[model samples]
Target: MDDQTRLELEAAAFRRLQKHLMEDRTDVQNIDMMNLAGFCRNCLGRWYQEAAAERGIEMSKDEGREAFYGMPYADWKANYQTDSTPEQQSAFKESFAKNVENQTP
Candidate 1:
């Protein structure tokens, strides 16, 4: 594939992942995702912000989150976030260090 095609394919895959996490599987908690997979919606948003920074887009954390979630982060939390269980929280705590090490807040 050409460079343009590869980019388009990657972008499409990203959009699909975003839709899966944000729209289709809203029940999946971010903490649980981080514990299990070492990343979550926040990480995705962070990556988005970093990518924008790479190209001089100057996106904020909140702005990147809003773009990914299709609403304000506060609103998304209010509507969809559930309290994490102790087990999940503990796992997340362990996972957090490694995950955050290579990413922005």
Candidate 2:
């Protein structure tokens, strides 16, 4: 496919994934996702913010999160976020350090 077509496809897939997480699968905890998948909704929002910066769009982290979640981060957390277990937190810290924090920029 052409470049534009490829970008469109990727954007569509991202939107679908966002919808799946933010709407369809709200029960999935971010900590569990970080532990198992090494990324979560916040990571996705950060990526969006980075992409905007790359293009000189000047987006903030909160703005990117609002774009991704279709609402403020606090609101989403209040409405959909569930409390994670101690085990999940421990695994998330390990997984995040290994999978994300240690990676080269």
Candidate 3:
């Protein structure tokens, strides 16, 4: 495939993933995703911010998050977030260390 086609395909896939996470699987907590997958909706938002930066678009973290979550981060938390257990927190710490720490945003 050509470059434009590849980019379009990738963007479509990302949109699908966002829909899956935001709409189809609202019950999946960010902490659990972080612990198991080493990334979550927040990470997707951060990446959106970074991508805007690459294109010289000034997007704040909150703006990126809103764009991804289809609402404010606080609202998403209120609507869908659950309290993490001690075990989940511990696993998140390890996962963050292994998967996120030292990575430049």
Candidate 4:
């Protein structure tokens, strides 16, 4: 595939992933996802922020978060986030570095 075609394909795949996360995967908690898979909605927000910066757009972190979460991030956290257990927190801290390594730009 040519460069444009490849970028288009990648963008499509990213949209599908975002759609699935927003619509199909409500049961997954951010902390649990962080512990197990390494990243969560907030990570996507940060990536969005970075992307905007790369393109010379000065987007705030909260704006990027709103774009990813579909509303203000504080609202999403109030509605969706639960109190994580001690064990979960411990595991998350321990696994954070490995998880960060796995995330793609």
Best by TM-score: 3
Instruction: Tell me the whole-model lDDT of each prediction, alpha carbons only.
Output: 0.90, 0.89, 0.93, 0.84
Error of 3 at 25 (Å): 0.3
Per-residue lDDT value at 67 in model 2 = 86
Poorest stretch of ten by lDDT in candidate 3? 96-105
Candidate 2 per-residue lDDT, tens place, 1-105, comes to 999999999989988999899889999988888888888999899888888998999999999999888999999999988888888888988999997799764
lDDT of 3 at 59: 98
Report the error of model 2 at residue 38, Å: 0.5
lDDT of 1 by residue, 1-105 (tens): 999999999999999999999889999989988988998998888788888999999999999898888899999999999988888878888899878875554
Q: List the residue pairs that clash in candidate 2.
A: none
- List the candidate 3 regions with Cα displacement exceeding 4 Å: none
Residue 47, candidate 4: how far off, in angstroms?
A: 0.8
Cα lDDT tens digits for candidate 4, 1-105: 899999999999988888788778866788888888878888888899999999999999899988888899888778777889999989888777676666556
Clashing pairs in 1: none
lDDT of candidate model 2 versus the reference: 0.89
Backbone clash pairs for candidate 4 read none
Q: What is candidate 3's CA lDDT for residue 90?
A: 92
Over the stretch 1-105, how does candidate 3's per-residue lDDT look in tens digits? Answer: 999999999999999999999999999999999988989999999899999999999999999999999999999999999889999999999998887896776
Residue 26 in model 3: shift from native, Å?
0.4
Better of 2 and 3 by TM-score: 3
